[model samples]
Target: MRTPPPTTRPAPPRAPRRDLYAAGAAVLLVTAAVLVGRHIQGSRHTLSVNWPPLLASWDPHLGPGTPAAVLVAITVVAYGPALAVRLPWRTLLPVAWATATAWTFSLALVDGWQRGIAGRLTTRHEYLQVIDRFHDIPGTLRDFTHHILLGSPDHWPAHVAGHPPAAPLTFVLLDRIGLGGGGWAGVWCITVGATACVAVLVTVRALADETLARRAAPFLVLAPAAVWMGTSADGYFAAVAAWAVALLALAVTGRSPWAAGGSGLLLGLTCYLSYGLTLVAVIAAAVLLLGRDGIRRRPVLLVPLLAGLAVVPTAFTLAGFDWWEAYRLLVTRYYQGVGGVRPYGYWVWANLACTVLITGLATVAGLRRSVSGLLVRDRLGTPEARLALLVCAALLALLVADVSGMSKAETERIWLPFAVWLLSACAFLPRPRAWLTAQAVLALLLNHLLLTGW
Candidate 1:
């Protein structure tokens, strides 16, 4: 009776190398399938007919002046780690992300260039139309440049007209690129910005786990809305850049408080630069707060967010700007009447899907990981509870932003992150069942879409 059962040692844990490689390959295949399917679906129109001139204008590494160069540099460095990691799956993850990002961005730039070149080719009136629009300004060219670049509250005409010329910073950057007219350049900037953002997102998710990173890689790279908006739409480049900076901040902050602060500052600038980035700021804040214990010991984590916030508006004010008027004139004009407060049924439906996707994955992850899985659970209080809270906050903020965003514009595309966040939460859960299944289904569907237009 005492010899009823022979004790056996637990089986050794399996190495993740195989799983990681499989995950990476699967994600890329799914991404490629989706893109092909979309292209085959005839959704790929020839927007940029004069792709030759545009391709000739393209410069990979160097752009123009301070801002342009700074942005491109950041874009490349932020993605540098993809080259350093040895895992085949890990390497493929970034490569896939970069490839998709480049394709989508290039497509959009071609579209813009086509439009610009066509306008030039078709009508003498086209160039004059642009100048006439600019010439209608009440002030001198210098005044117009200053006013358009940075709004002037003093002039009521500039205030009421509500359309200050294009952002001078954007134009200045374009000009340095040897772009005399900005139509195509604007498209390029937006695409690069969008690619940078995708890179940041992939990199951060990878930082969490290579497998998880691989899982998230495809959706972001092949996201329809993101590709279309970045490539097909204009004026969203800065918004894309803002998103990249925000995500970068989140990734860096994972290292220490000082990193957190710098991330915060970037987050703050994002808020200033694009109304869309308010969503990012909220997400960044939650990531910081939940991980605060990890960073609080370092303290410097608060500097960047605070400094950026302080500097942006303060600089504007010091230059004799009016805060409230500027807010109404610029901020309100850009973001107003957008994102339906009361959205259509699909809005509610997508939100529900996002919740289920995120929560299910996160729960599975929670079940899979043991209490010993967390590094500081014993000392930092309830790690699960804290993580849950932080995720919840981010979800709530995203929901609010998404809902509000829909009212303003067709933000359904940009809201892909809602789904991503939901999936990410599940990935962080303890079990693989929920996350693996959901992502698998998503990957398959996306693949089907790419391959067969479904």
Candidate 2:
């Protein structure tokens, strides 16, 4: 009898390798760009900007290094329980919520306490001014619109004159409840921080799967962007816009008509909150287009979504203010402000570096992998592809803002909204724990080493 043919075994699946080279190249490119851009900008302008000192004392009582130590300790304590336990997917939300709250409160604790919450809340400077007259909110809103549309000097506060009414509505609500001050600002930070954490998880779950969402939770809690989430109103704006994207993702996956409508309504509100948030529409559209039933379901989704979106601007119009005309004048006003002060050549690349710093090196590496996967048509309809598209759309929006020179400074805080989506890139990292630790280190360094006026 002929000898039996030897059987060959198929090779085991290969684990994906980390793209360190790509990540290193990205870092080098950003560093080179920042150096070159600053050189050119300094050569042309007087450079009167009050940049934060590279190393500054954040808390006198604790000392500079103490704040960094405290931040490191807080991050460890916050993440310890979750890391120690094997949590069910459903149970991760509460843990994530608590971790997010602690993370933000810890970062803001020294500043909020040292500055005196009331002083922090009530003090007005540059772009942000405390609403000294709460009763005038309505009139302020009207006048703000008028200033934007007709160039009438409403004598409005810089914050009011510079942004849509929705921007100040949060503070107005806080003031109504007798909760205005730096202390309340801390509370607002924790509240919105937790909300943003939950929104991020929900969006990830909606777009991908529960397993990925659970994996993403720890990273979100320790995000380098938390350095700003603790003190910026843009933190809350990030939460709102994140949920809007989450709701839209759920709608695309056939959640409900109501979800679609809710997404549109939130998106509309975000536009009124910050003009830059309008770019999130690109993200929403990407989700809709990439979905399995996108074409057939577009009408059902668009109808209620558009109607819900129209409500916000429609109400403003009825109040005798047109959003379009207001936005038009705001563009001119924007250029006349810091947008004109900072040259585009410098900010365009510098802003990108800031984004890379905020999002973490490992996350950027993952983003590179995701984009490469897209170009080669690997896993085209997979969850990873959808997430990659979402990230790309968000980055595109930031690029547009940077190119337009509408956002010239303090992007580390102002870009918190976009950072939310970018954090999703962490889901693709090979060693998430290492990346989380790196992110924590970066946050500590930022909070301790820099004294931001914002």
Candidate 3:
């Protein structure tokens, strides 16, 4: 009996070189995304702020883009914690926090300077600008604070239009709390808080996991779109938060009842601020279909979940004086005509086709019997590789449609998600060298051309 000792299995060997390669490749891709993103931000300055005049003509008392910005900031702050769970904290978090603070201060300074820039305190415009702190009060304080506090929401226009009165809710509270002493002070407070939230979200996300957070951290950090948009206004941040949460829920729980229900609820909430979340909902449905067995086992909760998802439009419809008009406005307004403008003409199409082809190839390679058997051998280990592959592919297709459907050549922001997923798809390949190299070359070249306007 004493001689009958049991055997123990050895731990799996660490693939350090492979891990290094993956990490290095991810960093390289993130660097490329950051560079392209910065170029897009610079392009915004050159576009001439025509919206200012349009907005003024429509609602002279409404102020400029501050309403939109404030709404988005609140949304960003609310969702910041979710992101913090997956992003690196010690280094990247501090930078995000500091930048947000500086940005808020800058907004206040800019607002105050605009009065002096106009060189008179007596004019109606100057007087209003002074009172409002040159629109910076709303932009820096209300919106910025909201972004830090709330993260982002979908369909931001509702809160901005006073339909929900959320923005004013904050304004009223600040007034009562003696936080609204001066427009600039409110702006600074909101901006700093919003910025801190952004950092916290990134840090929290990184701290949650070693492998994923490490890889995703840089892109989230360098994603100029996320930072610039959150800083610029609150809606963009809300959209990002919605997308991030939806993905997180899916990744953590797979086809569990909580996953579908939670994801659907978040999608519905997101619909309030940004309609783009509808696409995410569509993808989630596709995932459910592919995993129908697992999804159906939780049928008792299914009907309610579906009903909740319907609330997005239902709530919006009720908001309008006439539900039909509100529904129509939500559905038809943003269709600036499809067919994304690409100056490269056929070249862009060729690039997209090639990108899709490569993605398809990698996806197909992962479908080998070996891969399938490995997944089946350990059901709890991977939980259906085919489904993951399908999701990855569906995500890629959606990105193609998303980018290609845009009406502007400078719609690179819409295209970022596609680019990110394309790289992610490549990582799934067992032999990632060829796939990664191809994607890197294409991404680098196209991004450079897009940035340089070549």
lDDT of each: 0.38, 0.65, 0.34
Instruction: Estimate, for each residue in 157-239, the C-alpha lDDT of model 1 and write its tens digit.
Output: 32122322332233334545566454554445454544543443443442343444443344334333332333322224333
lDDT of 3 by residue, 48-77 (tens): 112210010111222233343343344333
Scored by lDDT, the top model is 2
Where does the lowest 10-residue lDDT sum fall in candidate 1? Answer: 47-56
Q: Please list the residue runs of candidate 2 whose C-alpha ends up more than 4 Å from where it truly belongs after superposition.
A: 1-18, 29-48, 52-85, 112-121, 126-130, 133-137, 146-154, 292-299
Please write out the lDDT profile of model 2 over residues 1-454, one tens digit for every residue.
Answer: 1222212112123423345666677678667755565565457542224341111234434332346446554655466434523565566677777767776666665455645223444445322354554477656556565554224554444445556777777777776788765567656855775577778777767776655565567777777777667666778788888888888877777647788889888988888888778888887777777654853755667787788888787776666555666677777776666556666656667777777767777667767765765675746767666667777887787787778777766677778888877777766665566667767777666666565545
Off by over 4 Å in 3: 1-215, 227-262, 286-294, 321-394, 403-407, 415-454
Query: If the candidates were sorted by their TM-score against the true structure, best first, what order would they fall in?
Result: 2, 1, 3
TM-score, every prediction: 0.50, 0.84, 0.41
The CA root-mean-square deviation of candidate 2, after full C-alpha superposition on the true structure, stands at 6.6
